[model samples]
Target: MPLDTNRLEPVLPWLKFRGPDDRGIWSDRHIQLGHTRLAILDLSPLGHQPMSFQDGRYWITFNGEIYNYLELRAELVQAGYQFTSKSDTEVLLAAYAHWGTGCLEKLRGMFAFAIWDRKINQLFLARDRFGEKPLYYWIDQGTFYFASELKALLALLPHTPELDPIAVDLYFHYQYVPEPLTPLQGVRKLPAAHFMTLQLDSWKVDLSQYWSLAQIQPLEGNISELIRAELERAIDLSLRSDVPVGIALSGGLDSGTIVALAAPKYKKVLHAFSVGYPGSPPCDEREQARSLANQLGLPFHDVELHTEALVEFFPELMKALDDPIADIAAYGHFAVMRLAAEQGIKVMLSGVGGDELFWGYDWMIEAHHMTQQKQRQNSISAIATTLGKLAHIPIYEKFAVTPKLPKPVRSLLVQGLNAHLIDNEHPNQFVFYNLRQDFRSPWYHRRSLYSQEFLTQLPERNPFHPSVGNDAAWSDITTHLCQVLFNTWLVSNCLALGDRTSMASSLEVRLPLLDYKLAETVIGLQKQYPNEFRNKKAWLKQAVQDILPAEILNRPKRGFEPPYASWIQALLDRYKDSVVSGSLVQSSFLNRNYLVKLFQKPYNNYALVYRVLVLDTWLQNIR
Candidate 1:
């Protein structure tokens, strides 16, 4: 059966890729719609997605790289599987024909693909472990609609799902609504490392997990040597692309390491890109990146984002994002990728997964101490109450009283002091447990939004099990840090932002650090090499010590920081009447007073500005 022309047209408009220039969707009239993509690998027309195999018994629309395709292709070749072209797409189809659902277990890369097994009369959708790629689906009126982006799925449905206010609340708190829930009520993001198979006739979906980080065996070897070997292997695999590839270098350890690894592998000098605002504290690292690039004998391109450029790109940037996220750094990422795209770099590597792979965040250490201190006695609440009386003293003064304690003990004392300050803070009288404080929307006050039953059920659904035992600091690295990185930072900041920003520029960005096998291997040996993650990627630094320069190796982790607040201020000042008087804040969904307060106090409030700006832009365009 040929695909329906009408249904295919709608999917074409949603495509963000530009390489090879084939954009079309395939819909089997009443049954299915398949979208074809042209990624970095397999540039031939035969390698295009929606590839049919087994005499048209199977069809697949795949996204992402399969690093182990060569190995899988070898095994399938021996199993009498013939290929038309050197493509992972054909390899995937043939592998699925031979192994069925078991083929998902054999895949070792970041991917989100949908395979319609015509013989089985079922459609299978799967996402990579750690959700490095995205797959969104919505069911409506006995019809199944799926896409790499929620907007495409929405386009297929007859009507959009009502805005999920609870999800909005979660967005303000976590900057992103975690899996199983989306901004729209009826849509859902497929969980990572899991697959969903739907019966065509009945339209019934069954989901199952194919892989888990918890299942990996702890590697017993010299930790530094193992890290070096695994990281090199992963980097080499990710660099397999026909088009010219570049690295998104932040003078940080992760990107620096990537540049050092990739520079020697490619035939020509690798192009490196970075983004920053002039005179900004975060922008100080651009010189360091340039110096490293010079030493590596590569061309360094710095995308200097001004307030004017940010304002110019703000509206489109908002529309490019899948959801209204408060990740301010995303602006800088998008700008750099846009510049990279203009420079004709099709594929680029990012330092996204490094922080999560290693215990590189302050919160990871803080959470470890908090989990341990809670066990000493549930005295946090009492200590917080006592510290409330010392509100007259500065926070450092309060901390001074608790000096001479162990590292963990000191962390707990700091936590207690901070909690006390929040509990007894001045002005708004709002108490905040999390760093984010903009979740005080009127919608949050609704009984249905935060039901007691939902709260009670949340503990069970908590991704990291409390009983997993965080007795050792290494447990923090393996469990809490890994969970936070995967479930929060990587999902929200790295992958989500990377996909949107890169795709917005029609560039494919890859993360070797987020490799599933590499993550699993690192997590398993976390406890064995406790000191490695202590100073955040200490082991990774040691492993690449020889390859990377001393300056690059010892450089502090400065994340991609965009000048959103400054940009917003400038925009508001320049186009104050248009923005404020426009439908953005005037919409009933958001409070005008709160929006005004946001502009009044924009320091460290880039999230607030981003959320409001994106929401405003979305509302203006969509409504």
Candidate 2:
């Protein structure tokens, strides 16, 4: 029943890169804690983890930065609290000492930390609002386990845990395991903006949320000015690091906005890093990135990846991302972080949350418009809408569109009819309005990829609902859509990919746009002016128009994507055997014959095949 120091051995090496500066362990009668230090602030022996305060009544092991630590520290000092070291870790402990769980609302940066309070004989855990940091925990035989990465958590288990079929189902449907669920049975990721407390005396665990984006009240101001001021302030706070910081630049507005504001304010020269392909494909944005870097008088660096390099890093990339994200663009993130690490830049800034917050995705916009039309239709008009679709039905082929409408538009119209008129489901949900005949739609609706046994294993739960109560008061449909994007795609895919890929090299990536305050402001702005989003990020463009280059402001949103055709074909050629006899088939979760047929025509089934291949490699690596 006593705490065991020996158990830490298995998970230590897996956590080495995440915190390579130092290692520390602490234990008492009931709980054991371990931490490996990255040492971003107060880089001295005083900054050691499992740090004690108030005569060892409170012991803490922490990860991530508190950008507003100085301000919080000054306020606590006024309240008769003192600190020995200038690290954010100490300030965090003091903040808890002063405010208890309410302290999470006061902190304004990314974090996932646990504090042991001997007075109450309890352990407390919390993650950041937007989930820029990672936290995973499991409980077995009355003992609780937690770590920043899934593999590290897996390493500490008594045995290799059973594969969670529900998690696997979500992965194939959503492309990543949604939080509060992992691929291993009995393990969970603490949902973001929430906290957990464990009481040893009674063995009781309680979880509660402290923040919700859907509930923020609208702020009053000229929307553009409010956004610009808050964005500038967020970037300024994110620059409060002792280590050298740089920006991951690209040809798009999101990264460009970061480079424009952050480069000038960063005390030292803020370098920009990017990734490109060998032949300068359309997806490559190195030239645009270099041009912006030149205009700003900042040094620019980029890595060129060939199909061979991508194929080589494919397995390693899956290992880097603890969850199977099914995103081929992950290599671009990993490549940029690796390049920055090589240049001795420990901290890098990324532009991850901008697109989701600003309605940048054309699909999201179209969904909103389609829903708006549905809301306005009466019974007769609804019938007329069906008739109109029928009028154009003859001209369109099976899953093909005419030349008059753009491809995206035609797809939207067809799916809109199916969702409302034909299928008669999901009248108000955009998450179900998928763009492709692939994994983008929910698992319940898909039939081609999943086997009958796997389908039977899935629970009758709506995966598209936000983890937070769906009935919470949202200002408008746009707000509802944004919240869904935040919960599903933004947290699960974009932020997860950014955090893991960057942390693979022990580098910290800060997304200033994801600052909770900025998020609340944007949510409020959306409520105050719902029509502004019809123009796709018009408020954001106006906010940074003067600071950014004219060309950068008006450019299209070609995100950091790969040359999919060549890359997928090459990857299929190299890792084909994985699907034929890999973990998916070995576990009886996939139909092997169906996968084999799909594998033969890689180009047609690229997205679904890419997902399955990643899952195969990930399962092998995990085992």
Candidate 3:
């Protein structure tokens, strides 16, 4: 078997940002395999990939670092296996040689790889447990196409893919396209923690999960301490790299804890990178982020963003993300990764998974904790308003005349006292509800007018029933909330954002929190010790209290974001041309004239309007 250089030719342009260091292609009559190297570990000729085993029984073209490869390699050596290179690629090939698909369990790191078993004449493809890395594939006419990025797949495959209507509808509701469904037709994301074994003879596609977060084997005693130990072990494993590694530090507890733990394990001085916004209070985390980095004795890197800069980068950023995401914070993450790349760093650690796994989100945790007292108060308020009671006059006036109140008062009334009346209005509310309830017209204003076709078909499908962890029981609303947030928000949006942004600069971003072992432990602990988590991220705060100063460790969640609300007017004004000229609005499903009005509407509607802008820009760019 060999690689066809011609098939390799089309993906080179797409690979420029993914692997810029070295290029190689192997070709023969039956097969073509190509790899562009981003040399993190074993920066030598021997580490070159599409790497093959000694007996030529297995070959793999892999993306992502396997942190525990050294341990695996040592075990294989004891089993009398020989290696030619120090790269994890060789170790993975040996693991497959020794344990077969069992290798998936023993491996730890973010990855998406295809291993060709020469003896069996089959190709095995696998993605890491939580989807920290991405794999897209398209199969047509007996030939299979796969790539680390969707852009590469589109470039290499002959299919002129059309956008899937269902995916487009999901994109509007969820803000990012969900898994197993890419924005395009004929291409799909390989669901995480799963692998597919493919063969040419029968053309059978056998997809199976090797792991799940919900699978419970009761581990007794002090799960928090065990979780802490597992998290520390994951950090140790993630530090396995030949290149300089850094942290995407923020003032928040998650990244702060990561830096505190990782600094002690790393030998040389570690670096931390953070992004700040000029006028934005929440985005300006430099003051506190730098303070934590100083205490940890790590070198710190920082960049400041402004509205003008975000405006300029909008179109390019949308184009880079193969599908559009309504996450404004994604640009902030991209900026920090680009900062790392400019400094010649190849790998960085991030704190994305801590929220979903450990109950860091306040609204999500409070969804079940809402008091009977609070619900009664809300109902009383509603009835009073309906009957024109004098006591409810102030509330009725506030609700009826939503125009004149200052920003702060309106926010309090809508988010706090009026929450149950509104069902779910906050972004965090979307974490608990299914797609239909989550996308209700009152909150997501555009939900009422989605293309008639999608609206007709939407009720037949449930977006929350993800393929990976659907077996997890949802009878306990708390457990259901955690799974929903983890699957949809953590995996599809946050993790995907980190992967694309970091890889765009040829850097690897590792999230120790996403390690399958850690996730399973957290889920187990959530089941047994659900009471301890009543307070937001209390379990995690206790775990790291010894390592970090209380001042830094106890800080409430501060999002790393530019002032999206303040900058929304400018952002929309800048992209108005893109919206009017964009195909999504031009189509019968959506009115361009109506979309223009939404974008040009009054203040305080930034979140909804920017989502429209993101979708419009992405549709135009992908076309």
Off by over 4 Å in 2: 377-398, 402-416, 419-437, 440-448, 460-475, 533-535
lDDT of each: 0.68, 0.81, 0.74
* Tens digits of per-residue lDDT for model 2, 528-566: 766554456777899999988888898898878888778
Order of candidate numbers by lDDT, starting with the best: 2, 3, 1
Residue-level lDDT tens digits of model 1 in 575-622: 444545455435334545545555564434555455555555655654
Stronger candidate by TM-score (1 vs 3): 3
TM-score of 1: 0.85
TM-score of each: 0.85, 0.92, 0.87
Q: Model 3 TM-score?
A: 0.87
Worst 10 residues of 3 by lDDT: 422-431
lDDT per residue as tens, model 3, 1-623: 25455878768778878888887776534566778889988999998877888666777889888999999999999999998889998998889888989999999887899988767678899998888888999887778888887778878766558767778777766778878788788899899889999986678899999876556554556866987999899999989889989999887888988899999999977899998877547558898889989988888999888878888998888877766778888888899999998987888998888878777766565554542222234244453333333212334434633767676655544443334432322212322433233333213344444555445655454333232223234234455566567667787889888888888888989998888777777767767766654457777888888998888766778758667776678887777777765777565446555565666657445655677788778777766
**RMSD, every candidate, angstroms:** 6.1, 3.5, 5.2
Write the number of the candidate with greater TM-score, choosing between 2 and 3: 2
Q: What is the lDDT of residue 473 in candidate 3?
A: 46
Model 3 lDDT at residue 234? 91
User: Largest TM-score belongs to which candidate?
Assistant: 2
Between prediction 1 and prediction 2, the one with superior lDDT is: 2
